[model samples]
Target chain A: TQLLEQSPQFLSIQEGENLTVYCNSSSVFSSLQWYRQEPGEGPVLLVTVVTGGEVKKLKRLTFQFGDARKDSSLHITAAQPGDTGLYLCAGGGVNAGGTSYGKLTFGQGTILTVHP
Target chain B: NAGVTQTPKFRILKIGQSMTLQCTQDMNHNYMYWYRQDPGMGLKLIYYSVGAGITDKGEVPNGYNVSRSTTEDFPLRLELAAPSQTSVYFCASSYSASGRAYEQYFGPGTRLTVT
Candidate 1:
């Protein structure tokens, strides 16, 4: 079974502080996705990184894919209270067509709290 | 386009009871998925349908069944509800192309409690 492990299960920081969450796995994935979820709501997709060593920035957030496709990371600079939420990393399982089009396995998630 | 929608935002069931969770999408997505999220844990796939009339088991498919009779609908049926089955359920849909994975749109989610 392919498993994704996230570090620092819980994080609390003051507003404007920077933080990084890591998602690691021994298995290589075709693609990786990052999501942020608020309480009582379904997770919203933040970004998707498919190529190795790919980096994508969304406003104050930065996401990176490992060169080997076995890990990923999310970094937030100058985090605001609104940025506090559950961050999840999901590894996309490639199908027969070699695309990460089918099922996706998720990590336990990192709960981030940004206090003002 | 309404994206994805799930019925019964909240529900409570007793052991041995049965119920069906309804999911629908208006985007005409070809891939639909059902997942369950326990408290403090990541979501686990329960079942998925590639297209109408085609379904497949996911990581945690036990005690659950699904059917896709039409392109817009995918319903999950739970038989003999147990305590372990209590969790928040989410429905998602996506469209896949040749060699690229499409983004999945998710529903608000349904919270179910089996006592």
Candidate 2:
């Protein structure tokens, strides 16, 4: 079973539309990260949320960590064609040494296509 | 810095063949990871190394082996290729310090196909 689950496997919307992607899990995580990947390239880190119920905004995008730390949501306002890409969410537990072993569990990913 | 570098941008292997995927990082990070991603799926961790001479298995370690003889290099070896092993492989590294961890830097990736 996938440790983390993402909703809306694929999304297609016109530019200037609003959209939200969800990432859910049953297990709790010490930290969760969001990444965006373009075609033929590795995913790039977008945001990291460690505290429960924390909300972080990056310009037109807003990310929120569920109060239970078991879910996350990414909302985009007035999306643009440049926002088109695959969004991934990854989670991992904390290590005793305070440094995780780099074994992060990733979601299936959401491919978002914003048409101009 | 080169960050994380993976050699052989693409490779085609026949069944039963053996080859090693090379990974090297110039960031001097203490943690390195190998992950495989199938089409339309998320990346699954295969192996990871904490430092030189310390290696550990991940969720999907089957059919793969790794060796970390130095802090800069972590190589993944496939003893016998199989069609099920064909996928995109990525190598990433992160700098982990006391109570803080940095984001992982990934390479351009190596696409391997086994027939």
Candidate 3:
């Protein structure tokens, strides 16, 4: 079984502060995705990284995939109160049959509370 | 489009009771997934379907069942509810190609409590 360990399970920061969330795993994945979920709602996709050592940016958030495809990171620059939410990272892999089942192993999630 | 929709946003079921969580996607995505989220556990896949008439088990499938009879609907059934089964259920859909990764659209989620 594949497992994802995320660091900083709880984060509380004031507005304009920058923070980073890390997701590490021992198993390799074909792709990694970041999602942000608000209270009472399902997670919303933030970004997807498919290549090793790949980086993607969306507005104030930057995502990076490790060279081994076993780890990833999310960095928020100048965070705001609106950035408060549960951030999740999920790793996607193909089965032995070479089928991309779209099954994802998710991290425990980091709950970010950005005070204004 | 109503990317994905789930019914009964919140529900409370007694032990041994059975219920079906309804999910529908208007995007006609071929890949649909059912996952449960606990307090500390992020999201565990309960079941998934690649297309209509095809379903497979995920990491945690012991107490749940699912069916995909159409491209639009994939409902999850829980029989003999247990307190351990209380969690928030999310339904998601994606248009998957063979090797490429696609974005999955999720429903608001169903909060179920079994006592």
Candidate 4:
């Protein structure tokens, strides 16, 4: 089974602080996605990184896929209260036979709380 | 567009009861999925349908069943509700030219509590 492990399961910080969350895995993936979920709601897609070593930025958030495709990270600059949410990383890959489209295997998740 | 919509935003069930969570989309997406998220845990896929009349089990499909009788609807059935089944359920849909590089759009989610 492919598993993604996220560090700092819980994070609390004041506004304007910077932080980074990491997602690591032993198995390689074809692509990785980052999502942010608020309480009582489903996750909202933040970014998808396909190629290894690729970096994508959305406003103050930056996402990077590891060169090996087995890990990824999300960094926030000058975080605000709106950035407080559960951050999740999901790894995607094809099945053994390669005949079917791949599914996502997600990490446990990182809950960030930014106090203004 | 409405994106993805799930019914029964909240439900409470006793043991041995049965319930169905309804999900629908208007995007004409060929891929639809059912996932459950427990406290402090990421979402786990329970079932997915590639298209109408085709469905497959996902990681956590033990106590759940799903059917896609139409292109826009995928409903998840829980036979014999148990305490372990209590969680937030999400419905997602996606579309891709080759079905390889696609991103999923998610619904608001349904919260289920089983006693």
TM-score of each: 0.96, 0.95, 0.97, 0.96
Q: Name the docking class for model 4.
A: medium
Better of 2 and 3 by lDDT: 3
lDDT of each: 0.90, 0.88, 0.92, 0.90
- lDDT string for model 1 (B3-51, tens) is 8989999999999999999999999888899999986689999999988
The digit string of per-residue lDDT tens for model 1 on A8-97 reads 899999999999999999998878899899999898989988899999999999999999999999999999999989999998875556
Q: Can you write out model 2's per-residue Cα lDDT over B1-115, one digit (the tens) per residue?
A: 7778998899999999999999999988988999999977899999999899999988899999999999999999998999999999999998643243346778879999999
- Of 3 and 4, the candidate ahead on lDDT is 3
- By summed lDDT, the worst window of 10 consecutive residues in model 4 chain A runs over A94-103
Decreasing lDDT order of the candidates: 3, 1, 4, 2
Clash numbers, per candidate:
0, 0, 0, 0
Tell how far residue B106 is off in model 1, in angstroms. 0.9
Model 1: runs farther than 4 Å from truth? A98-101
| DockQ metric for all predictions | 0.60, 0.64, 0.66, 0.60
Which residue window of length 10 is worst by lDDT in model 1 chain A? A93-102
Best by lDDT: 3
lDDT minimum window of 10 residues, candidate 3 chain B? B95-104
- Give me the candidate number with maximum DockQ: 3
Query: Which residue pairs collide in model 2, if any?
Result: none
Q: Taking the tens digit of each residue's C-alpha lDDT, what string does model 3 give over B5-110?
A: 9999999999999999999999978899999999878999999999999999998999899999999999999999999999999999986543656668899999
Error of 3 at A77 (Å): 0.5
Better of 3 and 4 by TM-score: 3
Q: For candidate 2, what is the TM-score?
A: 0.95
